[model samples]
Target: MKTILAILAGATLALAATAAPAQTLKSVKDRGELLCGVSKGLQGFSAPDASGKWTGFDVDVCRALAAAIFNDPNKVSFVPLTADERFPALKDGKIDVLSRNSTWTLEREAKLGLLFTAINYYDGQGFLVRDARKVTSALELDKSKVCVQAGTTAESTTKDYFAANSMALELVTLPTSGDLVKAYEDGKCDTITTDVSQLYALRLTMAKPADHIVLPDVISKEPLGPVVRQGDDQWFNLVKWTIFAMINAEELGVATNTLDAAVKSQKPEVKRLVGTEGNYGEQLGVSNDFVVRIVKAVGNYGESFERNVGAASKLGIPRGINQLWSMGGILYAPPVR
Candidate 1:
């Protein structure tokens, strides 16, 4: 009888655990603003303008979520955080979402009690050296002093990469990206190593931007995206689908300029995407036209990318792997229906 009672107790506890609710959506709704954690100032990703208005690829993700929930892109509060403070702020509920330029790794999701929603940017680590160095590849970076942020994957990855290539590495660690940039500019390190996208962004901030060149060789795969505190499946789904919806919109050729025509499209995929055919958005705790609102306010993924980081912007970084699956790159999103 004791063994049977023990089995019943275990089953009851399991049910109770599964029954615990996710409060993120309700808490954000009640709070009247979606608090988002962003980088201190990564230009193409997340940064505030002179007027203190946040605008960039990562910032738009937060604004897209706000539009989906409240039909207002301005219903978000941007919290600028450093590399070390980002995860803790999200875990402590100080921010509803972390749209910082953080890479999604196994240890981060499994060990840090956080969930990476989706890969918003496909990036890889690379080296940036002075143009006068006449260096064309990463292999040319032997016996160099590299500048990198202290508390980042790039720090360990730099060591591993140099060790694997039989190159001697002298690391110059700084507390933040800004510090690392200053160190590199002040001739503290021979080379700067970080995500290629970051290298592009940081280089533009330098006094002599044209004097540096980013090497073509990429070392580590850095799949960067938005993150949320673990155990909130509802909030997770909301963020994941928001990005997917934008990608899908781009794949279907539903852009902001042609939004009205997209809504009137007779094709089934277009109909489903523009809310003329399905209740998909309702299932995710929003109205059927949630994607419409997102596209209207922030625009689809391609528009966001172009406006912030692509050829239209000062960064001029090509779409490359961030392009849709249909367009040579591997960025595949699920169907909205």
Candidate 2:
């Protein structure tokens, strides 16, 4: 009887230890800025302009987080990381969150001790070839050299795709996105493969963007989003809901331009979202007007998409399935209430 009681007490203590609240939110508040990991330099996703001001879809996610926590969008220090360096950096406490266009996968979450907040961008793997090659389909690239970033899902996905189709492949794996682009541009490889959105962004860096084309064939589902380390439920919830709030704001037609009107809306959902009706933000460890701060900083998800990589921007990628659920896409978020 004594032994059984001791074992039961040990089990309870272990469970309590495992369920301890994560200190990431408090750490960010103490540090006075968020340490955000981003891609080395993926245009329209996370890149610094000539002025060194970071602006892109991924960059805006971190900025919105900063706004939600500090009420200042600029309270974030962007740390550029390569495909191989991203996870280790986040796992080692080098960054508070990673928003570098990383694909959310089971292995990454379970094996790497990381957690993806939400699918901020729905993407798929695709091929990019110079128009001069006249390659209209990825299936035609048999025996061709493919340039892909090493340590990325693209590397493995490309290999599996070719093997599955019984096509010959000569893969030129590089260490960074820039290296892959340079290799392709220098004729070291016949084509490059990555997320379709990245292909579009990379094309803009070429000498003649019009000379490259992203093939219509999509090979893999790449649900990209911000990632936080595991064991920090508080931080995870904050990050997850920050994205959800932006998505929900878009669905509710509460963009930055319409945010003031949303605050005055009598609708229960809008009131809860704008923090006039409930303590949802308090529940998340942020100010009651957290959603408003996010919208004011980065606008809604659609607004950020349009401004960075969508039709309104140079990338000109269509909304396609990234559109709001009610607007014919899969982008749906839970209500604030």
Candidate 3:
């Protein structure tokens, strides 16, 4: 009986070890294309052009993952999801990864059984108002009607901020970002509140983009990043490290423009990043040159940022805190070594 029990236990252990890679990665590999959840139509983060081509910062993250996995950035299906639908889609296995600009909060992970991989954008709650309103600060708008998207941290944060400051707030809560913007444009509210990054994006959609101004006051911390389902350590690590690889590439000055030289780099960190020195990508269940694939597809984090939402883009938002740690921002990644 003792021999039989020992043999059964060993068999159980073997099965567990075999299942260690988790189902998400295997399913993605089998499907031949990654299902990435993105915002419904947030320009600069994730939006479909007139030709139905998706492009933006968040879209690039999904493309980077596809490039890492399939060596083809185009091997991805972008699923547009609303704020309320995003989490459920991810939880229901409708999407493999959520690259929507979602805020990372404790309640989301602990309550929803999801995991935020990493904070790709550091943001804050801010207000946007028509420049003609003559309001330069969020605190100055007393008894103002504020438009915010429902089912988002922005709605709750706006409420808390108003109450804390002893200001009267007429809240106009909308179901989607489009609704919020429409409400704001239709004079349904005196101001709109959301993440500072989002506010910039929203402003661009206005009839006269220069007529509105994003307030300088940042009320709450909003660390936005990619999210994956919990319990899939392999998938979680892969997504997290994918973002890290982008950040590290930017720090190492290895971008899409310099990718050819990066492959032959002899620097210890550069070698590991370019896959000439170590098997870091293989350990993540991808090709050893996964970083090369990612960089080639989306350039690096900074490149994606500048191209989609930074000064080079229509938004013209400053790099601010999203810059690399060495360049006075909090953006830092673990060494590939």
The most accurate candidate by TM-score is 2
lDDT of 3 by residue, 1-337 (tens): 9999999999999998876755788899999999999999999999998999999999999999999999999999999999999999999999999999899999999999899999999999999999998998888989999998877999889889889999999999889988988898988997999999999999988899899999999999999999998878889999999999999999999998999999998899999999999899999999999999999999999999999999999888899999999999999999998
lDDT of 1 by residue, 219-333 (tens): 9999999999888888999999999999998999888898999998999998998889989888888888888999999899999999999999999999999998888998999
Tens digit per residue, CA lDDT, model 2, 126-178:
99998988988888999999999988899889989999999999999999988
Ranking by TM-score: 2, 1, 3
Better of 2 and 3 by TM-score: 2
Candidate 3 to truth, TM: 0.95
Error of 1 at 317 (Å): 0.2
Clashing pairs in 2: none
RMSD per prediction, one decimal? 1.7, 1.3, 2.6
TM-score of 1: 0.96
The regions of model 2 sitting more than 4 angstroms off are 1-11
Off by over 4 Å in 1: 1-19
The CA root-mean-square deviation of candidate 3, after full C-alpha superposition on the true structure, stands at 2.6
- Looking at candidate 2, the ten consecutive residues that score lowest on lDDT are 328-337
